[model samples]
Every structure is written in C-alpha cells, then in structure tokens.
Target: MKKYLVVLVSMLGSLSMMGQTNTWVNDPAHSRLGFVVKHLTISEISGRFADFSVKVTTSKPDYLDAQIEVTAKIASMDTGVEMRDNHLRSADFFDAEKYPTLTFKSTSVEKTGKDKGKLHGNLTFHGITKPVVVDVVYFGTVTNPMNNATTAGFQIKGVVKRSDFDLGPKFPEAVISNDVQIIADVEFSPNK
Candidate 1:
C-alpha cells in the first residue's frame, strides 16, 4: 500500500541520518598549535602559530573514526621574540613568503586504547609532503554552560625532524636541533 511504503521510507531515512558523519570545527579561543626545539644544544625555544584552522569529521561520539585536517599560516609563527621570529620566516628557514601555509590531512586512525589512538597523516611543509604519525589522547566531551554547546577536547603530540623537510638547512645541529616536538591541544564543537 502507498501509506505503508511512505512510512517505511521515512523510517529508513531516519536510520540513515543517525549514521551520518558530523563535522566539528576547532574553537580558536580554546586551541593551540605549538612546537619546541633545542636551542644551542643547551636551551630550548618554544613557539606557536597564531593563525590556524582545524576540521574533524566523525560518525562516532568517541571520535574513534575521526578524520582530521589542518591548515596553519607559516608567517604566523610567534616565538615571543620578534627578531628570531622574522629570521625564522625568512629564506634561511621556513621561507614563509614562498610556502605560506603548512597543512595536514589524516590518512588513517588506529585506536590504541579506549581513549588513545595513533593518527597517521600527510604533513605538507616547505612544499614537501611526508607521512607522519602523532599520538592522540581524547579528553572526552563536555557541555559548555555559556553556550550549551558540546565540546570535545584532544591533545596531539609528535616529533618531527627538520632534516626530513629540509628546514633550516643552514643551521648546524649544534646550533638548532634537528628534532622538533609538536604539541597541539584543541577543542572542537559541532559546526553550525
């Protein structure tokens, strides 16, 4: 009967909607993308990108099946020192004028534990793309009292070699360590 067919179609549509993926956008006010590297083989220097955007897509509430993408402006690097920051953005290092942005797109996600996972992705920097893996810790989700919006938190940590991307090739290892530690703490809310 026509009535029965319409009801069945509506039921199926609702079920499909329940399984649809949701997109989450990073909250800039609650997120940070930073890095640390050894300076002069004794001290460490830390810096963060001032402009970036992250997007996450998932069909699960736990983020077990999440796909993440990020774009960060290379010229936005801030190390609290204007001279050093400008030098870093020059051709001697990032060459920010040529490669204006760094980007990452997840290839796969492997769950290591209930709240831990390994995120494998392609990181593109300085016009080079390399596969990288980062450890992810899900801090779970909470409802914000101010806006009544559900927000999810995650911390991602990884180590990258500057040599791999041919970054700062002019600087010796003793002057600037080849190893750079990347750390990002991000909060995401469903895209409106």
Candidate 2:
C-alpha cells in the first residue's frame, strides 16, 4: 500500500513539473537573423533572412534547459543587392525555390558562465544538415513598458563553412570566403 502511494505521488510530481515548462515565441519586430561573409577576400557582405520564427521551451528562468527550434524562409533572404540576392537563391547557392527553408533544432545547451552558454544543434540548410555549436548570451528578461509583457533577449553567434554544405561551389575562397558568420539578436515573450 505504501509503495503504491509513493509511486502515484512521484508520477504526479513529474506531471506538475512538466506543466511548469513555458513556451516562448520570438517577437519578430525585435529580432534579426543575419549573416556575413567575405567578398573577394577583401570586403565583407552582410545579409539577413527577413522571415524566421523561433520557439523556445524551458522550465528554468535562465533557460539553461531550453529546447529551441528555428525556421527561416530561404526566399526571404536579402543582401541589399537585387542581382546578388537572386543569384544566392539560384542553384549556384541555396536554390531557394527547391529548398524553401532552413531550420535548426537544438540538441543540448551547456552553461558556460553567469549569462552565457553553448548551444548545440543540427542546422539544416541547402538540403544538408550538420551539427553546429553557437555561443549564446542571455541578456536577461525585462517587462515591456508598452505591452506590460515580459520579454527576454538573447544573442547567438556562430560560424559555418559554405563548403561544408556545398553552397556556392563555383565561388572560390578568394572570391567568396567559405566561412560565414551568423549573428542573431532575438527577443522572446511567453506564448499567450
């Protein structure tokens, strides 16, 4: 009788904990997913995917155990130059018409400091998926004055090789650098 009661209590406790997990959705108006890569080994060019969504679920306030998922529309990519952007969407680059989207789903997050961590995830782009580790900085949470809602801010930075995913194969390192730097500034609010 005592063993049965204990088991029931344990199960209930687990359920309660699960219920505490919060789902946060990105505030698109305050977020940017951008990247930079060298152009001609001299100058650098920057671009951004204007359409993306990020959702994070966690029970901890610091988000140490957060599970994050991201999806960005490849067709929304903008490089400030119409011709270059069109080129990037073609088969020589992302082939946006065929792939349509890039995604990431986090596998683990390791705390490194008071407000920093390493996020490990699988990034799918250009029809290829690869493991990636990005540095994360939590800028803490604040109550929005206009909406009276709590918002959290974070910055994620990483570098990925275009060659690894067979992106822009015709472009050499001297013309277009292989290393692409990704930087995202995002804000999230608890889903209502």
Candidate 3:
C-alpha cells in the first residue's frame, strides 16, 4: 500500500510539472510597435502606436510552444504630423471611435533556427480579423544591470494589406500604398 501511494504521488507531481506555464509581460518603456506605409507614391511614412501591451506564455524552455497576445490602442497612433494623425482616427481611416483597439493572438509559432522563427496569428483591426505571419528574431534574455531583473528581447516584422483590414482610403495604391509594413521591438519580463 505504501509503494502504491508513493507511485501515485510521483505521478501527480509529474503531471503538475508538465502542465506548468511561464508568463512574460511586456516592458512598455523598452518596446515599440511601428509601421511604414507609402505616401503619394513618393516616400514611406512611418509611425508608431504609443500605447500597447504584450504577453507571452509558454511551458517549453525553447519557446516553441509559446502563445502571444498583443493589444494596442488606436488613439495612440502618432505620425509626427498632427493633421495626419487626426485623419487616421477619423471615419475614412481607422475609425478609432468605433474600433478603439487593434489586437493580435498567436495561433502558432514555428521555429526556424536557434534565434529565428515564424509567428502565425490573427490580427484584428478596424473590426476585421485577418491571418498574419510575422518573421521573428529572439534576442535571448539578460539580467538588467540597473534592476537585476531578467528581461527578454525580440524583434518582429510583418506586412498586412490596409484594404484587408478596412483601414484607410481605397483604390489609391499609387498614393497611400495598400501594403503596410509592421516592425516591433519588444522587451518582456517575468509577470509579477
């Protein structure tokens, strides 16, 4: 009876270990969410969303089993020009009042190298949900010299069609390009 109890306890402990997950929260001060879009076929205009949050969760050390979620406030968009920023929040563009947030939830993560991978997810913007695959670079983790807290860094690049997300003006690829390039530099720390 003692032996059976020991085996049962060990099995339960193993099961609990297998189910454990680690969570990391974004450090906004060290992260950025930015995008580039063409302007009048002249040059590219770049901007960033100043308010956003990201969370990563995984049970695996390699992060191959990671799940990521991000939420960004639409009103936080900044393009340097106040007029352009206001236009982006208007009805012809992001319609920020109706859809105040853009979000992404990872559906899968595919490892390609020791520090590279592809993150597949659904991005919801302007009331539309579209699948997107982002090229990822994991910069690994480090202990901050100032605070001694462990932090991880990552960079992601992706593109999404503005039309697909029902954002911005229509039929003007020559003007504002349909394709928007998204680039993010993210830093994460263990959730407290």
Model 1: per-residue lDDT, tens digit, 90-110? 999999999999999999999
Sorted by TM-score, highest first, which candidate order results?
1, 2, 3
lDDT of 2 by residue, 1-192 (tens): 999999999999988876598999999999999999999989999999999999999997678789999999999999999999999999999999899999999999999999999999999999999999999999989999989999999999999999989999998999999999999999999999
Candidate 3 deviation (Cα RMSD): 4.5
How accurate locally is residue 151 in candidate 1, as Cα lDDT from 0 to 100? 92
Best by TM-score: 1
Better of 1 and 3 by lDDT: 1
Error of 1 at 62 (Å): 2.7
Give me the runs in candidate 2 sitting further than 4 Å from their true place.
1-19
**Residue 171 shift from truth in candidate 3, angstroms:** 5.5
lDDT value, candidate 3, whole model: 0.93
lDDT of 3 by residue, 1-192 (tens): 999999999999988877789899999999999999998888999999999999999887678899999999999999999999999999989999999999999999999998999999999989999999999999999998887888999999999999898776654899899999999999998897
The 10-residue segment with the lowest total lDDT in model 2:
14-23
Total backbone collisions, model 2 = 0
TM-score of each: 0.91, 0.90, 0.89
Candidate 1 vs candidate 3: the TM-score winner is 1
Model 2's lDDT to the true fold?
Answer: 0.96
